[model samples]
Target chain A: MATMPASPAAPSSDERLARTGPATRIMRRPEFGAAIGAIVVFVLFALVDSTGKFASLDGIARWTDSAATIGIVAVAVALLMIGGEFDLSAGVMIGTTGLVLGLLVTEVGLGIWPAILLTFVFAAAVGAMNGWLVVKTRLPSFIVTLATFFSLQGINLGVTKLITGTVRVAGIDRGAGFDSARAVFATDLWEPYRFRIAVIWWIAFTVIATWLLTRTQFGNWIFAVGGDANAARNSGVPVHRTKIFLFMGTAMSAALVGIMTALRLRSVQAGQGVGQEFTFIIAAVVGGCLLTGGFGSAIGATVGASIIGMAFIGIAFAGWNTDWSFLFLGLILFMAVMVNTLISRRASAGATK
Target chain B: MTTLSEAPVPTGEKILELKDVSKSFGSVIALRDISLHVEAGSVTCVLGDNGAGKSTLIKTLSGVHEPSTGTYEVLRKPVRLSSPRDALALGIATVYQDLATVPLMSVWRNFFLGSEPTTGFGPLRRLDVKKAKQIARDELLRMGIDIRDVDQPVGTLSGGERQAVAIARAVYFGAKVLILDEPTSALGVKQSGVVLKYIVQAKERGVAVIFITHNPHHAYLVGDRFFLLNRGRMMENWTRDEVDLDSLVKAMAGGAELEALAHELESLGGAAASAAEEVADVVSHPTRGEDTR
Candidate 1:
């Protein structure tokens, strides 16, 4: 954190910065603080857990599995945020997509393969609607997605009860093509220690997202639109297209998590994934995403999710109530932000002189 | 619409000619009777005070806003631009007052931005990292901009360097007509000189540069043709041989100096004239003083 520049700096030091000065190099990365935070939290968990199992390979698998779902959504949320918008309906859309898939398989008697395809299209359409509404109305995405959040929440509950008379939908395993779907989405991997396929999905998503953000034309536009939209628009960037794609991407990622959950548990509740939007948002922010937008990384969100995972399982392993995880994450988030701010400020101040 | 034209092949030609162009934002008029010609290999400056419709003229030319009236000729053919992209399609690029460069993004990324060079196809398509870096470096070098690294965030560059990078990018992307909005308005004296140097460099490379500024000194340093705008109208037009630094400054001041001179004369003469009258009248009116009272 001490290495990153805090403010915009003059061009002379830029020469030295190009040489990879430790301080200048670190300041360039928005996620440096988050990386450090993740490391600290991991070490603390390993050292303090009363059960030594927290340090084992199985423990790594346990925490990683917990982190995978949130990590997947958080990275996409981070990208959307970098493009300067929010998708508040993400958590609810998870429920919405999952329920739609569950019902199609259980009641509609559709194969998992077909059900999944329909579910994806459904989620994408809803996402496209959210993006379109945001661009057309020129409303703050917070307000826009909030409307979506409430709407989807109602639909998930109302339609589920209307069809099943119960909040939960089960018998997903009995549906045709369930085994293959599980193999793709919910299977366990590695011989001795079972790891969820979702973890592999999370890693792949992060890599692709990172490449898309940092190594593509679209990635450049993401930063431009987020930093200043009018300026970006004036520069010939298709600002609306960039934003809409981002919104759709976020929703689709959440839907992937929804599919994985239903396939693994063999059921999805009507209220599934409700009120969990904040977790994805918090994880992104903790991963070094700027709340104001235009600055963050996909890897950073992944690192942030690991912090949450560590706290969730570490508290349990240390013989403490798992509820302490929330308090622990909250404190870590505040500290990470403070550390990042202080370091960047100093780096910028030094550059001007 | 010459997207196929390559850089370093600039033709010494008339690129953009605007005649009596006018723009109104609903009820408020921003520009009227605006006429200017930007010639390739020359620096044409649009000079104005704050709110003097410089931005409107820029927007109109760069395709951000279409002129409500008059003919905007590109490459000797009149056309109405629907968007900045349209203007770019015709080889007209605008560098705005609030620069479009993303501060958190690397220099190379900001340079290639919308027209980024990429390889492969579809979802597998990725930016040509080496090519982009090389070009960014080469372009900056061409502009005489000494950037230490292409990967550094653009915000680290001083105001002047950033403007230089924007100019270099405009040139590298084959912009025949470059419109700069207050490029040196936010720069220091030396930094302003640096940007002025790049304006000349662009001109040497045969790019028609429109350098907009409120600073007469900066304009005089590089401008070959100057257009003075005020209150939505063209106040004055001067070629390089026709205008001097003093006249340019005086015009930009909008008669403030003349008004101040009149005020100074009124106070200086009134006190002296009144005092002389009192002494002369006292002597001349001594005999009639008792009667006058």
Candidate 2:
């Protein structure tokens, strides 16, 4: 019942009592609590893993190496989610992009940069298809992307066997421009520690995604479309175009991860990146994104990826079974959701009064 | 005494003028020849029933749909508002009953949603949070809405408060012609009064307001000019001086038809009074026995 009192016609004592201070007036963002939680988790992990390997530069590099790939994908997925859509084909897209590049280089005798460009174009085309199907058909993105996922999965295995006569494509390092491309994608930044180039790409992606989601006009459209598509459309926002852009962005991110992985391994495996869509979504939701959309941050998605990376490494370092990682991820996702729900409830309740 | 010549000029003075606007979805005509004018610095109330063309009229004015055949004028210029952005550019902002705002977003964020200001050095430019919060607070205060915090999600506010916030936003964003669709139709008596006060505030600020509602009392309270619509057609267009409250109410309630129906029902009830009294006595005695038992 501590409500904002009605304005008085004359100056009154009640008016003075009801006035709130400026410091107390700052609107509470949903990400604030999540940021605090991330910091606390980081400190806790740092404290408990006091062993030299856990605290060392090598350990930091190892954890971040794992965190980067997931972070990149998660950020893109978060944008798509905020734009009120989903891309189930994101995970499978990695295999498709890598396979496409592999075929282009070895079978088609194309150079590395052309292969990369072609792969990106293919990724964009696939993304466009997803967007076109979703918009034109007026079908749920989940169903549309699921269809794309299965179709791409089939193509990945079928095409690799047809081109390479094997389930994997190797000798990418022997291709033209291989040395320079590998230097850019797979090079160890620190010689002794072997910190990956992918980690840099991940951080860069996070920065760009955060800027695009929070600063640009497109970001506003994304939030509006996710929050209420009908309303956004009525308000003159191009909801369909924004969603299409989001879908394409996600596919491109997955393709980038695929290229990095193929370069790092110097091989393209048809089975790579299958069944990992849920992980990207889980990471985003744990980082303080609502599955319902309209509220999430790129930084939060990165933090969520970091948490996943930490847990994966930390548990292994503790000598626990790596298979238990899924269980731990599920538990963390539940806890994060519970905490987020409570914070949102309190924030809304505070606003009402 | 006022002469018809001295009456308000029916010239190019309308901020928003809809002429013979009609819309049809296949064979069903949703709206038919709905001609209305909303002048600057005044409230033109559009009254109607559930199936009436109120929504159609709103959609047309707000640029959701192009009228099948009618001219729409803004600032006396006949222009086709193909999109809501066009309407907004012309300083015509519509605050629908549902109010286009993300309930989970902070009041300040919702206030400056599509048009957030930014400040800072290159690559470090961020939302002007301080300015946004201050402006949101000031605008709401101008509308007589004193909130405890500008940071709170707008969803937390009451229905009336949300409507007021939307009005405040429209006014702050240079909305010269504000179209509010059924703003107070969902509120309680006290809440409706609060909304009406803000509507009056918008008028006092020299903004032309198109207040659409079914409530005659609420409309009469702040509306300078009333345009009543029934079945997608204008029933009566009257100024404050021309029509009294009773007449306005009567017009909205279908005037002669409503009065005739009331009279007929009254006579029918009086004729059945003796027979109804015997039946009521028998029902009352049985009810009394049941209650006693």
Candidate 3:
């Protein structure tokens, strides 16, 4: 018998190995692709702006208002993505929540504060139900949430017409506490440009979400559960609870956006926010959230939302045919995902070497 | 080089003992009358071929499955484990091949995955990123694993490095009985050597290492005792002194069974017969075959 010699690749001075440079480190970030995409799109829109105001403070306000609403939900959707799930009902959830608030104020004769609070509760309950069905049935969240999306679409239209005798609910401005609710959710800031309060909310929410994803224990569990559910379970991570909470978060964010829209307009149509689910998911994917889950950043989702918002406002300002907007979006999504995959592959390989 | 003519004796305390353990999955008996005890600071190799109940034995030991009939004692105290977490609490960690680490996550995150150490108080408490990174780096280095960066995803690491990370994690988390399910089965020769070195290092750290592998050469390299399993039964158990490399290989290769298979192949004649004869030749003269040992 021969005694085995120790492994030759035993710990040597790793200092002799190449250290990762700042550029490589930055490139390896999950949000790197989104950040680059955002810059390029911003430049493209600024160059093509026919009104020239597309690069001004007024233009910033207009695009930010658009981005803020999408950003809020996209961030939460990004979190859900990182936790390995999807919420297709998120867009329709806004309509469900808006209609719920509309009825509570205009029909139920409740104050704006009470109606807004009740709408949040309704949305949270629905979100929890979406989560419960996903976890219990072990069905793809796509199928389960799609079921929810269709069900809520029917409810939003059917219930609104049933109660108001019209597909749209109005006259919410007359409800008690309407002024304070509007100031908080839909009020504008700045003297001339008038930035929407939702912009502030978006920034604040992004900060909170970023912190939750990077600094906390729940954040780690999110990555683990998304990356490998079995490994997470084996490591004693609470996979079910994390996923359910992620669903609740996306729903609640939708409610916040819904309430903001309702208060700002003082009315809501039953079909409001119908197809916005794709926009939210598109923003997340563009922002560097993997469609398969287990990787993303809140800031990346925010940047992704900004890209969509810019595209919407910028295309109209550029006097181009707005009909081609979706085509542009498809191209951006493809390019962003391609860039992200390529960079991540290169970065991982480089770091290992 | 250390002396190889004589077998090494394990003189440490018995840390884990399984007495007449048997596990059944409804109608199918996975493990039967499996009795083995592991000593602290020693490597116990469980050698078997495919479908030889090695995975069942690892699962039973790691608390993933409970024995239908047997007593499992840890440090002389009989305990029934409800889950892997329970086993973890008792310092028994099982590292499963391909299921050990989250591939996309950073090395530091995978290191402190389930039981992350947090700083601050109340809701303000967060993962101690700085401290976690430092400790993960130190722990891997301690185990002779020089990772390029703690922030790199585990998927970038070679197969052997991933196993080393899992082993380091188990060791850091106070795993008394380390159950590695075929840690080297998926690795190349050099990579297998890397893992085998860690097994010895883990044993040197006074860990009761349970190294599972199909390769007898790997077992002979570090194992202080050997348990051969066949069809869920403990076919043989031997101390290092009672076994030699040649007999160990012949026994694992199924001494008489290989001869029977070679003869059966020879009946095909021509090229098949010549190939079978060569195989028979190697089987008859084991030293003339691959110097895997």
Candidate 4:
């Protein structure tokens, strides 16, 4: 038998490694570009604000309120993207779930809490259906969820108009347990500034999603399935199950935002969340999620949402045409992705050297 | 450290045996009348060119495909395998050329990809990141892989280092019989040497290694016993003492086929034919250092 090396040899010439410094290491993270982008956008808006309130605590509350709803769903969409799937149905799922909540409370005469519970069950069923179809049919999730998007869009308008004789549902404030439900989902916290409770929910979801991605077995599976599905399956990872659950997660988070929006407005519109799916995807991509899959961060998605939120409020405060906002967002996406790609290339190259 | 078994199993114990194996896909025969045995602390090299039934043999051994007629045995007891997982459960692990690793993932994460260890209770449980990283670093070091950082992505590693990672992973996961498919085919001269070193390291640790390669030089360097496969048949089987490098190369190249090619070239050309004849002579009478590259 061969003896163990008598002592750990000095760093050999053949495998001499050049370890990274703190700055390079930090820049190597998948979310670093998004983090930097968030700061730059904040500073640029702060410099150009015409309405002095745009830089105040009240403005912070207003912009974060806009970001929170998008951030909530964006976090889950980020997870689904990392697991290598897309849910085009996420945006329409909001309208569908809100209509369900509004109908259950106003027409079915159920308590606000029970109606909310039934809405979640409905959302889960749709999510599960999206997941099952993607796994069993082996079709691209983009195609399957796109079909779901169109179907749900039709159902949102058709079912709401058929029952309520209008394109919207109202009188949610008169339903049983309205006071308690509003306190949980729609209440404004803190005096003077009156920050919305949804911001806290958004922050909490971000924390949980980050923990799930970084510190859990499920998180590892997400990265694995996204990185290389064949390698993962050969290594005994449950590829299909992980992917299905990611689809379900995106659907369910959309439902949460739907319920919150319905509660805050005390009404639901058929087209309330229509066309918002692209917004969630934009937030995720700007946050450094790869369209191809396997590499991203949840906090990055949150940062991306905040950047959008700032742009929306900042543009209005600067008295610029709101139409220019989309152009600015497109530019932001391109720049964030470019910086992320370059930094990642350098990080990997430096590590090997 | 917790899973490392320092005491090697006694040598010369036959760990795996395939008896009278023949596999046919529909009407086409892929492998016919094949038999081989692997022992503890030894390397069995299976040498074949492309489409020489090497993949079929590997599949049959690793349970990706079942032999049409054979008794596959492990530890002298016949066992039927239905899937790759079944083979893995029985301590038979196959590392393909790609090495079954996600390149973008960190080394520690890829090391514990499928079977991650978690610590804590109920919903509060989490991946034991510190333990996984430590064990991954230690196990790789034990295999002489000496990776400085377990956090580096697997893509940053060289081809040979990735092979070492895969080998080390299989060993740490309690593989008794490791099947390596062309581990050196994509590597350079130095990288091939590195992978060959790890194969020897694995053999010395008492793991039965079945190395499948197309290169005779690589096979002859570390192989204890050699099996030559040609056209879905076992043409020759010899122990290290019974064969030398030149004969091994000659058998693999089919000496008659080379001679015929040399003759064919002579009739077709003048300068090129002379060059071809000279090349054939060097191949037929290979010098030790001259042919290794």
Candidate 5:
């Protein structure tokens, strides 16, 4: 019997083999494709717009306002996706929150501030319910949140008609706290430019969400829970807590959008935000957040919403019917996803040693 | 002090010990009558084939399963561990075959998944990204794992490199007994050698390393003590001086079974010579060249 020799590779291989250069490191970022797509879409819209208004401040604000509403929800959904869950109820939750606030202020004879606060509480409960059901049942969050989406859609329509005898509720501005609530949620800024306050909230949300996702311990947990929940649980990460918070956070973001819409219109329609959940998901995927989870960033979703906003308003500026925007969005999603898949394939193969 | 083989034998205090340990699920005994001692500053290789109770032995030791009989001791003190967390608290970190890493996360994040370094105060406290990245780089460098960039996603790493990173993490976290579950089972020759090198480094750092692998070549190269398991039973145990590579392989391949086959093949003589070599290669490299069979 031969005694085995020690490995010659036993000599220290720890010489910092070859540090990845800045360029390669940049390419590996989950949002790299989204950043490029945002720029390309911006340039294409600028070139196509016949009125040259797409380049102007007000036009930028017009799309940014649209983008901000979608951006706020997209950011939360991005984090949810990163944490390996989804909130299909996000769209209708917006309508539900708004209708809740509208009915409380008008029918229940409550002040606007109290009504808004109660609406947030209700939204948080719904979000918690969605998360608890997903974790407890071990069901795919897709199925769980899908059920939530249908239930909330029914509540938004049924509850509104049941109380008001109409599909819409109006006159929320007549409440005592209406002036302050409008200032907080619906106030216009840079009046000449027609900028909505939602843009500021959107930017703030993106920055805070970006910081939380990339710069905090909770952020690391988000990646872990999504990457492999079993591994994350074995590693002693609070996987359930991380997931629950994300679900609740996403629901609250939708509620904020709902508040903004209700305050702006002083009315709430039963079907106001129906079918918009797909829009938020579209922005997230376009921003490079993988639907499978564990590989996306909040900033990527923000960029994705920006792209959507540009397409929505840019199509109109270019003298085309605004209905073409959905077709335009489908094209961008396919193109961005294709680009992302190609890049990630190369990035995953980038291990040099 | 240095007579020849520098590899230390199982001496000094035992970091972990199993005495007449047996585990079972109903009537199915996964492990029975297995006794082993892992001493500090040594590599103890657990050798076995597919159903040789290796995983059962691992689970029993790592607090994944409670032994049905006998005592398991940590640092000479007999105790019971309810979960992996309890074992980890006692510095018995197990780097399983999968490495338990988040592939999309950066190396630093993966390095400190459960235990993150924090700075600042209260709500302002964050991950301390700069410190985490630096420590991840430094700790891996200590293990002689030449990582390219700490910021790169861990999925981009080779299998061996990822294992090295996991091992380094265990060491940095002050693990006294590092349990590596089939660290080289999924690696090629060159990559396996890379991991084997780190096993030596880990031992030199005074860790009682439990190196689990079926490959006799890897086990023989670094293993100072060997415990052979077959069908949920301890077939034999030997120190470095008592066993060599061929015997280890024969035992791992089931000594009686291989001998019977050897005798049967001898009857076939010259025509079976190539077939015997093929079997030898398959036995030697259990992890590779499997498709040919």
Candidate 6:
């Protein structure tokens, strides 16, 4: 072999930064623009909505209370999406889980804790099936989850009818330890603040999801599988396992939300979560998650839920017809998607350069 | 630099030995009776054309697929590699053409994709970011790769740099046998040279390198022993002392067929030259070179 050339001297930090150029400049701070946009929105809303309810602690608590449930589900969906899969069944799985729990404790006379554990298991099994079908058939997750979504929706209605003789399952409040379970799941953390327990769970979920997506070995697999399935598989990342876990996570998160909702209402309805799937996905996308996968944060999704919460409450507080909420949401979704698209393009392009 | 004669006798101690390994996809035999030896600290170049079962052979070695017949040995011990994990545990790392790196992920993240180091208390533990960054930088630097930041996504690096990172990662993970699939095929001239340098570096570190490529030029540059495959069969095996660059290129390019094509082209050129000369007086010379001018 020829004599090895003298190793190129390492560049200094400044020189290295310069080597990054504009593309690296963008990559060095992929989320800076999004952060700025969030800040701008916060400021804009804070300024325009200086009215009594807008600036009051009551309004803050109410907005957060509204944001909490959606945020939890959105964070979980974000993780699943990052793992390069989608879970359309997540929203409906909530109803299934709550019904199961409601039926278990109220009708079957089972203990609350046992019912909760069994519901989680059932949710996880549904998730595992979703993942298995997707991986084994090599089908698109969008289609796979869509099928599961419809199937679960049908089951939610059909099973609720079969068990309760109606589309609603009630009498959950009559069970023993109902008060304790309600305190655990739906208790207001701060007195007079009316903050729901789901808010704490949502925040905890955001923190945990963020940690799982960034710090853990599982996080690495999530990115790998989403980023490139073949490459991840070649690297021995267990692509199938990662996707399955993500699906399970999505379902479990939905189940948790379902449990909270059922506890808060003391009843489970078949149609309760039928239309919330799109809302969760929109929040996730707005929070900077790429629908194509491999890039996102749980915090971003939480922020997205906050944005949605703000628009919903702000419009109503302004005395505008709340019917415009959907229109406003659609517009926000469009803008968020556009912004995320640009960021993703810049991120991928920067990496290539 | 040690000359070939001054270098220690290789002792025929095969680090990885494949004996009559065959594989088939349906009725088509992808590889048949392919036997080869990879010695420690030596580069074993497997040269082949587009469909000569180069991929099949590598997949078998990397545990992506099991060989249908024959025996394979690792460090002189016959063992079956059932999965990619098995191959990795056996200290065999395969760096494919795509390099198995997530484009959007940081260089260090890609470097330690599956095996990440963590530190802290309990389930709330964090990745050892400093250590991971330091190791990625050091390992790549040792391989003569001078990337700006390990924090940058691997996709930002040049193709050659990416290949170097993959090689460095394999070495850091204690890989005794490194399998590289067409590491140079997708690179430019300068980039190819850079990757070749890393291949030599790995070889110098006593790692048995399996350099798979259709490019005989690359094979000649780093290969200590060459195994040539054609039509899913082993055409020839040559030690460094036995083969020259020209012979290797010819064999890869279909020796007699290339010669025949060359002869045909040469004959056609001669005929064209004679015809041009005959028409020279009548034709305009504006397109001709200085001699005509």
Model 3: per-residue Cα lDDT over A114-187, one tens digit each: 88889988988998999899989999999999999999999999999999999999998999999999999999
Flag regions of model 3 displaced more than 4 Å: A1-7, A10-18, A350-353, B1-11, B259-280, B290-293
lDDT of 4 at A325: 94
The superposed Cα distance between candidate 1 and the true structure at residue B184, in angstroms, equals 1.1
RMSD to native, candidate 5? 5.0
List TM-score per model, in order: 0.91, 0.85, 0.93, 0.92, 0.90, 0.89
Evaluate all candidate structures by whole-model CA lDDT and list the values in order: 0.83, 0.78, 0.88, 0.87, 0.84, 0.81
- DockQ of every predicted complex: 0.29, 0.24, 0.44, 0.43, 0.37, 0.42
TM-score of chain B of 3: 0.89
The best-first sequence of candidates by lDDT reads 3, 4, 5, 1, 6, 2
Worst 10 residues of 4 chain A by lDDT: A1-10
For model 1, the superposed segments whose C-alpha errors exceed 4 Å read A1-20, B1-12, B256-293
lDDT of 2 by residue, B1-293 (tens): 11112233332256678888888888888888877887766777887767778888888988878989888876566788787877787777999888567666668877887677788857676677788889999999888888767866677677778788888988888888788999988886667777888888888777788998887777777878888788777778888789776666656555556445545555568656555554444333332322211
**Model 5 / residue A127 / CA error / Å:** 1.9
Those runs of model 2 whose alpha carbons end farther than 4 Å from true positions after fitting are A1-52, A350-353, B1-12, B75-77, B116-138, B141-149, B266-293
Stretches of candidate 4 above 4 Å error?
A1-15, A350-353, B1-9, B260-283, B286-293
Best by DockQ: 3
Interface RMSD of each: 10.7, 7.5, 3.3, 4.5, 4.2, 3.2
What digit string (tens of lDDT, one per residue) describes model 6 on residues A1-353?
A: 73333442222222345454675455434243445556666565666674667657777788888789899999999998888888888888888899999999888998877888899999999999999999999999999999998998898899889878999999888777778888899888777778788889999999999888888888988988998888787777888999998999999999999888888898999887888888899888888777888887788888888888877777777677789989988988897777767766665553455
**Model 5, residue B286: C-alpha shift (Å):** 13
Please report, as a residue range, the 10-residue window in candidate 2 chain A with the lowest summed lDDT: A1-10
Docking class of 1: acceptable
Better structure of 4 and 6 per lDDT: 4
Give the 10-residue window scoring lowest on summed lDDT in candidate 1 chain B: B284-293
